[model samples]
Target chain A: MRLIADLFLVVGAAFTLFGAIGLIRMPDVYNRIQAGTKAVTLGSLCLLIGIALLYPAWWSKLLVIGVLILITNPLGSSTIARALLKAGVKPWSKASVSQPGEADR
Target chain B: MTLTLLEIVALGLLGAAVLLSLLRLILGPTAPDRVVAADTLAVITTSGLVIIAALLGSPLYLDVALIYGTLAFVGVVAIARTIEGNG
Candidate 1:
């Protein structure tokens, strides 16, 4: 049981690390939001579950946190994306990168 | 009070994750980019808080994690709405 819990924790941490890397490496805010939200949400859930396994008595609190993340993470990311669009932020595209002069128009 | 090897590795990975996210938060080119980084940082922090609770062998920290997660979500939504400029 302890071994399984450790595996979950390690895997969750690794996923979170990937999400952060994506946030840094992605070319635009949209990509960064997608990477950060999806990966980190899953990572967090895994971490919570692992913690619950390690301490079974804490399952109720862990479940609450997990559910909160599941709902809010995606909702928050979408809200940010919508806000960015409303604020006139353009999404990055291959065409924009390939034809830099065209992007200005 | 000693951590097992796996716990240490998990902690290291989470620490690296936090550093990377912080780098994005600092270097992000625009407001929305920074906001996204902040949101990601909040989620990571929530998980990290839970891990800390486990490490400390206390249930009290779980309440902290819960409250932190709730407040972070509310804060993010408010920031996003302000950025949207509907008002």
Candidate 2:
């Protein structure tokens, strides 16, 4: 039990770290949202599972938090993307580089 | 409260994750970029709270994590709506 719990915690933390790295490295807001939402959602779920395993009695509350994250993370990302679109933010594209004015908007 | 080597490693990784997200929050070029970083930071924080709960062998912190996650989601939505400027 200890071994499995530890493994889950470590793997989850690693995934989270990668997500943050992606947030920093991605070129645009949309890409950053994608990376941050997907990776961190999964990482958080794993962390919750690990904690549940470590303390079996805490499973119910952990499950609540996990489900909350599972639902909200993607919803929040999509919401932000929609807002960005409505606010006139454009998605990044390689072709935009050739057209400097296009890149600005 | 002694931590196992694996737990220590996990905590360190989480710390590094938080720092990276904070850097993005600081350096993000646009408003949406910063919002995304903030949202990611909230999720990481929720998980970090759970890990801390495990470390301290206290179930109480899980409630804090739960509430924090819900509020963070609501806050993100509100910010998004503000950014949209239509509602």
Tell me, by DockQ, which candidate is best. Answer: 2
Off by over 4 Å in 2: A95-105
Candidate 2 lDDT over A1-105, as tens digits, reads: 987998898999999999999999998898899899989998888888888888999888998889989999999999999999888888888654675444545
What is candidate 2's lDDT per residue for B16-71, written digit by digit as tens?
A: 99999999999877777889999999999999888888888898898999899999
* TM-score (C-alpha) between model 1 and the true structure: 0.93
> Candidate 1 DockQ category?
medium
Output the worst ten-in-a-row residue range by lDDT, candidate 1 chain B.
B1-10
| C-alpha RMSD over true interface residues, each candidate | 1.5, 1.4
**Residue A34 of model 2: what lDDT?**
88
For model 1, the superposed segments whose C-alpha errors exceed 4 Å read: A96-105
Candidate 1 displacement at residue B25 in angstroms: 0.6
Report lDDT per candidate. 0.90, 0.89
> Residues A2-101, candidate 1, lDDT per residue (tens digit)?
8898899999999999999999999999999999999999999888888888899989889988999999999999999988878777787865455443
TM-score of the first chain alone, every candidate: 0.90, 0.89
